[model samples]
Target: MKIVEQSGKETGQGRGRALWAAVAVIAIAAAGVVGGKIALKSKVNELVAERGGKAGAVEVDFLGRIHLRDVTLPLGGRSNARIAAIDGRPKILFLNGTLEMTGLDIELPTARILVPHASVEDANLDPATLTELISRKSAAPLAKRIDRFAAKRVSATEVAITQAIAGSEQKTVYRQVNLTDIANGSVARYSADGASFEFAMAIPDGAGGSKQEVMTGSIGQMTGQDFDAAYMARLYTEKAGPDDKEPRPLYGPLSAKAIAFSNGQARFAYDEMRSSGFSMRMPAEPLLETLEKLTSVTNPEELEPEERRAFFGRLLSLADIIGKGDMEMLGLKIDAPAKAGEAEGEKVKLAVDRMALQLDGRRLDAALHGVSMGEGGDYVKFSEASMTGFSWDSTLEALKKMAGLDEQQLETFPFTTLLPEFGTFRVAGIDVNLPNPDTGADSTGTEGYADETGETDALAAEGLMPDAEQEAGADQQTNQPVTSMEKPAAAVPERIRFTLKNYELALTKPFNGIPTDIRFSYEDLSVPVPAKAQDETSVQLRKLGFDELVVSSNIQAAWDEPSQNLAIKDISVSGKDVGSFSVSGLMGGFTKDFFSGDPAMAQVALLGLTAREMKLEIEDKGGMAKGIKFYADQNGMTEDQARGMLTMMAAAVLQQLAADQPKLQGPVDALSRFIAKPGTFTLTVRSKAETGIGAFDLIAASENPMLLLDKVDLEATAQ
Candidate 1:
């Protein structure tokens, strides 16, 4: 309606005309409100439909005001929307809306999770940009591209699909979603029926800082085809903004089915995973930074100069740990403290698998099978293990390269290169009867793994030694003899050393609460002795030698918790070159010196011995070892008349062993005088009986003289 007024300018009485014109203006404003309402109502209706709303309503408030009421946006449900703001802002303005969105509660799977609470103040949200990326990422082909080429190369079985759950304020196009902190908290749970996981996570108040959110409910199941890279390129290319023509590849595709994680941990399933070798210029990751720190955690330079060099070498060894290494079990168990319930790391297994690697040009191929990615992120138990095949081709090639030899020439060398430290591997017990590389027999060295087939044979011993020269005879004994007789049988050299193999040990008994059955082999050890009277006196050490050691020793013990008396039940031992000897003496009547001036006779002197492979178990249960036997001049003993004093000679030697002496007795006491004052040609120890005087073997089949080791200059080396 053309309602025109305000003719006050033409009216002479302007005040009166203005009043009439104001009334006209008010009348026109009332009608204009009706028209503005109609236009705004149409606008609101269009917006509701665009937002998937149905049966929406609009209302106009006082002057130039409009309100939307009970406006529902349909996601298969009904809701309301309200918005209010000034037509043209002069100073302050405000707009607010409350939404109660009921989620799609279909046959969703159930899950329980506890999420730590966190928050952030500034998020710098780019609703528009984020929306575009999200839209692209959620595309059936694009998201599928991420899902398809997701594993480097697509598997015939496995596929991934992602759909928009709750999109950003604007549509987004992403090559692959970098969920960032969201990815940190979110976990994927899926099965092998080509069903990808579709989950809805509660967005945190903010993305970073202390912000955290955990959702515990079934999101959805995805049974769609995976998108390929070509699809991703095509999808993004079509949606590409003004300058998106360059087509940047976001996250690189995976070359292997496994997801290689931080700290060198990896996880993968066998069938569903597709792997293709691809070079990844791994853009700097936080994990790499962390591992670098670990590599330098214990600085080699922290050690002393000489020690530092060795430490540095060991640290360098760890650099190629993924290539040339062995499995050194640090630990395995349930509820590992590190990483807690998260996936268990693959440190040891990877090393073992890498043990057989060879650098063929720049690429490395394992001579053995690659380690299987463990089923569960586990520690103690391995449900599945990788096995290796027999092929020494790489080893042969390495040898040929080094020596420039042909196959015929290489044949001259031993194919089995022995690791001196590792020794030789020989099967002893339960044999898997695996064919040998050379001998091709069950007797050949072979291994049996737990997961595969036949029962495993007992693990074999690893080291073997070359044959040694047998001791010629008692005459072969080293050192000078006192009476010039053949060497003592007890003085034979049978080298001994300790055997330390990994053996399952258990407590059998305790001698004085010290655990027994702590058996160990002692081989290739040497002991020495001295010549004596009657039977040769010697240190018998036939229980230690150069072969397999079998030791059984009982400690000084008692039935009660605390007891004074200590008795050794049995300390039996067996070795290839070792013999057994048992002896016992009462620690009675404390004396300053045993064979010196102040000495007491042992009431019970006992010792038993059995010669090598002989039934000669001889034992001597007899007289005390008098410090010295003297021959007095003519009838009785007078200091001046004694030309050769036996007691003095013996005491002199005994005093060297005994630090202190309280008394002296008999000829043994007299022998101390010579030792106390040296440079005297007194009675020397003899291996045989002298024409008028004598000394004899103490502990040997053939008596021999004692040569003191203290007198030898041990630093000598032959030219």
Candidate 2:
């Protein structure tokens, strides 16, 4: 009986000890849970305080879930942000979570943006690294920290932004915006739908005054692909080193559809627009800094003249950051109603089928297709126009320089320096149609110039007619005043038409704002002319039996820098069923001073110019015969008589010319033969002096034609 009692006591003692140990373990776990909650809340408050923010009611649950309410944060400068509530579910120690934010609002000095709801799914975040990145106090590479960020999706609903610019308010609203597959602080895709904006401001009225302008615009959809949010953020927040040359793309491709804008005076619309490959050549930090400086100024107008100029120069420097990009727009149209005092049906209309621009480094290439302007029967249209290899480097530099000039200096600024360099410019399939100048309804017509006899006044009043002797001769032959030679007004056309197949200009080399190697040409150009046109040239063309002028011309010229030589390779103009004329010349003594961008300097340099050699050729297809017939009709004589009279007159003039210098005798004889027979004629002129004739000598010879023969060697032939 004694052994049994001892065993039962030992078993009871062991059970009690086991129960106490279990109670102790439960107490320890309970204390740890309370401690973790308190610690998480404290940390939250601490971080908010560190960023100059305040947080109200922070709560943490046992599962590491967090909730915060009434958050207010400073967003740098004069900007502040507020959040109504934030909820986060942490998968690992608050380092990653699904976060939702509600009632978010950001207020700037003159703007405010509001978001009703925003959310991020499966977001991986590091608070410490993010803090460092935002502060920009660390020297670490942006990619390093940005790479640590990732999220499956981020979205916002019903975002609104309102801004006040120049005392005018503007508001923009977006219905739905979202980003998907966000990783490395960048987004694989982004989209926004149903965006609209309205604004009002005062703009220059182009009459030394300002006018109130109201504008409204809308976009049905906007989308971006592969947007580098992190790099862009870094650019705005961090200063780049001098050696940062690697181009960083801001986005892969972006597009907008159903875009439209309208002001009180005009409406603009486009079916779609797209852009891609926009990058930064230099660092973006400078641009950011400049913007900051500009915005920080309380009253920019109060600044000194020099200070204002410096600020403008800094502003212009921002363009240097652009590296390369391309943009295209389709189906663009603009319309403006006729203004007061304008004629009916005179509304302005412009349409473009497509337009595109590409920027690579400092070069820009642009093209326009199917462009038309004006309304009613008066319009200009072109199938295509393009410009390639337009470099903005010099243009930007010139603008910056101008920006730094004071008012006094600007008055005398060398504007020629602002001319930009270009590779090639071409326009094809151009058509222009307009009412005849003479018959136009406007009072600027030729009615006031008519004489009492219903005949147009003599062209001699406009210095268009020949000398008095020739005028008298023509009048005597026709037995009437020269003014009566003009066709009656009833014979004029109602409208004029002009068309061109192509026009092109190529500047292979440009130096000091002048083309050193260039080729300019136009093909298949045609313009109709009325018989009674006021211009002497048009009258002559009509008298030559041409109802329409159809011609093509080309000019190819170049300058040799090393040798100081200017060569005009070809300057040719050809008219259909008329004739063709060409001129080629070589000159020396051209120097850089000729293009020094100063008018005075250029004029001074022109005095030192020298002419070396020149060649002129003319081929008479049928123009010569038409001219002889017209002269015979005007002079009341036969064609043969007219041709003989012209030949004798030319010979008589040549005999006088040969009196001073015998070198011109051969050329004069050849010219007489060409006139009599209506055949091809060629003339060549070479400088007699080894150094070529100076410009001063040429100017002097202009007063005494005989003097020019002494300075040039002449060759002429008729075929």
Candidate 3:
């Protein structure tokens, strides 16, 4: 009985002690849980504050993962203009080094965006530590800091946006925006699908009224990839070391499909657009210096006028970024009414299968294929056209050096002022169709244009002959010329005078330069000559029935003072169906002192000096003989009559030459024989002595015209 009583007492005491121990452990664990929650809440609040958001606006919910709701972000220190109702479900995977945010939503009164899912991979930096790194002052470049932050890859899928402006009834909606491996990847890809945009604006019409313009468009899909953008941006924007040869190509590829735009009246549709290998070269020393100066200024307005000019000049210098790339568009079409209100006249339709442009440093090439345009109730077509070697680098460099551009002067300089200084350029296969002004009855010049020979008969009746009374009346009317009594219209000077002034300013300082050759040539150029008065020179030329006309020129000019020489190497005008002619010459004995005076006076003096030593040779080949015969035939003249007319005209010209110089009578007679048959003719003239402008005046005033030619050399040949 005594042993049983003792055992029961000990068991009860042991149970009581065990119960107390368990209670103590539970209390300690509950206190620790509360403290941990408080610390997490404090940390989240600190983070929100650092990101410029109010802690009270953020709501935290822990349902296995972290969730935030109803966060407000101030805009430009304006609490009223703020981003409202931001919500997200974010889970931090510490072991995997990732932050996955799902169902993220952002809202504003005018605009709203929702991102279904976003994830940041390789997010190894702690939030607090990242905040400190960002907040701390450092001497490193902003590019470098950004590079460090971009070490992690961020991806977002299926982002949609809707926007509505306050004063506009239009709404814009964009859907399915996806970004993958945005920061660090071989190619960071961004894409969006099914985007609709609307715009409305009022444009001023020439007459005081306003025209309302509305535009609407849709993007079926757009995809863009920046090939190693983060890396290349760091390399190009950041300062380079002495050993760096050149920055690698900073390039990307882009593609878009099914873009359609319309402005109520006209519509444009493109099936697809692609741009590949777009690149930019890092600028040179001058451009770099300008960039550095720009960075030194916190406010652009603080810069002086000169500094601003210099900055802008340097910036314009870089506008030709010297990159190479290719771009292409497919299935482009344009449709519009040909006239303002006449849909029945002709609805214009233009279509092109493909258009492409390619650039390779200092060289450009472009091509278009399957082009067709509506013309005169039918479509004019072009299979393909291309051009190449269009560049302006060297000319721009020369202008820069000649202008003596200082850093300050370059800031606001307009580089287009130098456009007039560009060198030679060439283009091929350009087809231009000038709209005919006389498309109605005037184009046919007679009723029943479709009838055979009606136009020629009408022209013959109207233009070939005139009655004696009418001719007499016309002479009497012309004898008394009617002059306008109204005050002359004041000439409005062109706005381009300012640009010309800039060019003159560049030339204020003398620059000894090399020879330059500039020419522009086009092929298959055809233009119809309209009906003209009987006195026009081209009226006779058109009667020759030439099918087409081509105009081409080649000029080589040089000025050298030390060498005491000025030369025009060659100037030629050649055509396919028309005749060809050329003039070339040289002069010597011009010194530097001759050009040291006022430019205009110097030019006059130079011309005088050149006139003393000038030598010119003029050449012609079968130029006007065929045209003359064609005209005489069209005028119903016999072959013999045409021959007689040709001979009489030749004799008259030779007689005039004889009047100028009896010493050239033999040559003049020879030239007449040369024109009698289809042959080439050449004339050479050389000055005899040093003559000034007074000599030309004397020749002009001389009653004995042949005496002037006798003072110089003249030679003519026919073969």
Candidate 1 lDDT, 113-214, residue by residue in tens: 111111211222122222223233334543333332211111122222223344412111112121111111121221122222223333223234332222
Tell me each candidate's TM-score: 0.19, 0.76, 0.60
lDDT of 1 at 716: 12
What's the best-to-worst order under TM-score?
2, 3, 1
Q: List residue ranges in candidate 3 displaced over 4 A.
A: 1-45, 54-65, 73-142, 149-174, 182-187, 201-210, 227-250, 277-331, 339-346, 350-517, 520-524, 527-566, 574-578, 587-673, 686-719
Which parts of model 2 are misplaced by more than 4 Å? Answer: 1-39, 93-96, 126-147, 201-210, 263-265, 295-313, 340-347, 395-419, 422-426, 436-496, 503-522, 530-544, 554-556, 597-604, 628-680, 696-719
**Clashes in each model (backbone N, CA, C under 3 Å)?**
47, 0, 16
**Candidate 3 displacement at residue 707 in angstroms:** 5.7
lDDT of 3 by residue, 1-719 (tens): 88999999999999999999999988886776566545555666666665676633444444212335445444433222222333332323443244555555566656666666666665434444344434334455544554445324566665556566545545455566655654432446767776776776664544677666677888788888776654455444643446544434555788889989877666789999899867655554434455667667776455676665555556555655556789999999988767643435556789989999987665566777777776443445556755545454545555555355556866645443343322333333334342223222222222111212223334447775455576567768888542232112222111100000000001111233222233333334443343431323435555655433445545555555556655656666665555556666666655554444345645666545444333333344445656667757877997668877888988898889778657888678768876676456677666676542243544473775544564567777777
Candidate 2 lDDT, tens digit per residue, 41-160? 676777777778988878888766679999998988989999999988654664567889999999998999999999989776444644554444556666556756778888998789
* TM value for model 3: 0.60
* Model 2 lDDT, full chain set: 0.80
Q: How far out, in Å, is residue 608 in model 2?
A: 3.1
Error of 3 at 19 (Å): 26
Comparing 1 and 2 on TM-score, the stronger one: 2
TM-score (C-alpha, index-matched) for candidate 1: 0.19
What's the lDDT for all of these models?
0.28, 0.80, 0.55
